[model samples]
Target: MHLPSRRPLLTGTAVTALLLSLSACGGGAAADAKTGEYKLVQNGVITAATQSEQPPFAITDSAGRPTGFAVELMNEAAERLDLKVQYKTTTLQGILAGLSAGQYDIGVAGVGATAERKKSVAFTTPFYWGFTDVLTLKDGKQDALPDFDGKRVGAVSGSVQEDFVHREMGGANLVKFKDQTALITQLLSGGVEAAVLGGASADAYVAKEPVRIAVKLASLQGSAFPMRKNGDPRLLKDIDHQIDEMIDDGTYIRLYKKYFHDPIASDLIKERPKLAEQVMNHPDLAPSRR
Candidate 1:
């Protein structure tokens, strides 16, 4: 119920030189920027925005230190691009505002890049893809959207999954909550017949108890970072190139496995291979394919 304020980690985030000097070409750092159109500033630093709380993406342990796959990926990207980077953690609602205000150069919150989001900032190719999964009581009468036509559905307010569920199951009554626990409570108390959850977050609530994946909903659309529009597209192009290279060079997979795979987090690791194939063949997602 309590929303924490920003925890500025700008001083702790490490940045490297090569990342700053690299020309924002369509591919990884310009192979030869010595004669490139732009030269990085001597004190170039990218202020990156993230959430104050969230794990596997961005989170701090008991000691209050930042650690996660995103921090590492952006740090390495900074090194490669020759730019010093600072990570600033804030609420999801604040990140975009910060991006627009120029408080941060780019925002990273495992946020999916949708046409809706594109209106605000340019998104690099998706760095990762995930999907929404619906959860209902094991003994519930529903198994899919059609089954819930007249039932009440619980979802977190402002979440993409909520939007998807509202769009996917039009007849179902939607109940909104501000947090994950609250949404689940409404579902368990029979306040709602089902709950639409984001990415691999459904498991976070049902970990200790038993639960089932009612149905695999739409692809999360995929998560991408946001940068202000305009010539930033050039920089976005370079970021896209790095992501492709990361995917091919095993860097992306390594990072994916670290955050999505492993025992501490099997939910992300246990991906539906078929879904991945479907993602590749998806025409709508082709623009930001990596």
Candidate 2:
């Protein structure tokens, strides 16, 4: 499928202000869910910026509305708060920069909470967490992370996997693409030995394509929502609180299974107790109602 080029909406000083504005609060008066009032980018709508392409997480439906796990999850949460979500599509890199500029009140697109990303925006507690995986054609020569050493490996530019490639897979020939589809195409065409990406996305793709996960890399990252730093404290709190309710009521797991087409395995949950507990709603971790 054809996709628009990843380009900045604005450059120079304007770009810096949006990203840095998080350090200082900038918005209308505080929002009150009870009264149905919000300090939104536009009144009566939450301008959500997201990647135009990430599958099973963020995508434009046939009707032109954004519909996917992360997008719908946010949509449901917004419904509970009585606010409408107006999605604006952009590339992964553009979403964060635009969010920083206050162009979008929320940003979602399979974003993981990495230290580097936190500098640009604040993350909600992870709604989903899993290992990164190396994906290659089933008949490809690469079989594991070690096998790709000094060989070409594809990752979306600025994605967490790209950082992992530099930090853990040193000496690897890194090939960056604007989107996952392109990265996987390179891997299939033998342009790269393998592509490093979220295990879930890799698994989903391989289910329909002639590819397989070569290695489930040890590095684990948690995907979450990104809001401008110091942007809207009340909005942030409400979102976190809403997420807690969703987990408590099993809504999050339902969404996870619907999109990923499988439950987060029991053994995997055991390995990441904290993340599991958050999504599972252990009695001790349940949040109080407002």
| Candidate 2 clashes between residue pairs 3 or more apart in a chain or in different chains | 18-100, 18-101, 19-100, 22-229
TM-score of each: 0.66, 0.78
Top model by lDDT, which number?
2
Estimate every model's Cα lDDT from 0 to 1: 0.57, 0.70
Least accurate 10 contiguous residues by lDDT in model 2: 1-10
Q: What stretches of model 2 exceed 4 Å from their correct place?
A: 1-36, 261-290
Q: Candidate 1, which segments miss by more than 4 Å at Cα?
A: 1-43, 52-55, 137-141, 179-193, 204-210, 261-290
Candidate of highest TM-score = 2
lDDT for each residue of candidate 1 in 111-199, tens digit (9 for 90 to 100)? 66778877877776666555577788776545556777888888766667778777888988888876566777788887887888764
What tens digits encode model 2's per-residue C-alpha lDDT throughout 1-290? 11121222334354334323421332233344452566778887888898766777887788887888899889888888888888888877888888788888888778978888999898876776555787878886655456777898899998898887988688789999998878878887889988888867877788888988777643355788888785776777787667656754678767776887433432233322333444334323221111
| Candidate 1 colliding pairs, count | 9
State the lDDT at 55 in candidate 2: 75
All models, RMSD in angstroms: 12.5, 12.7
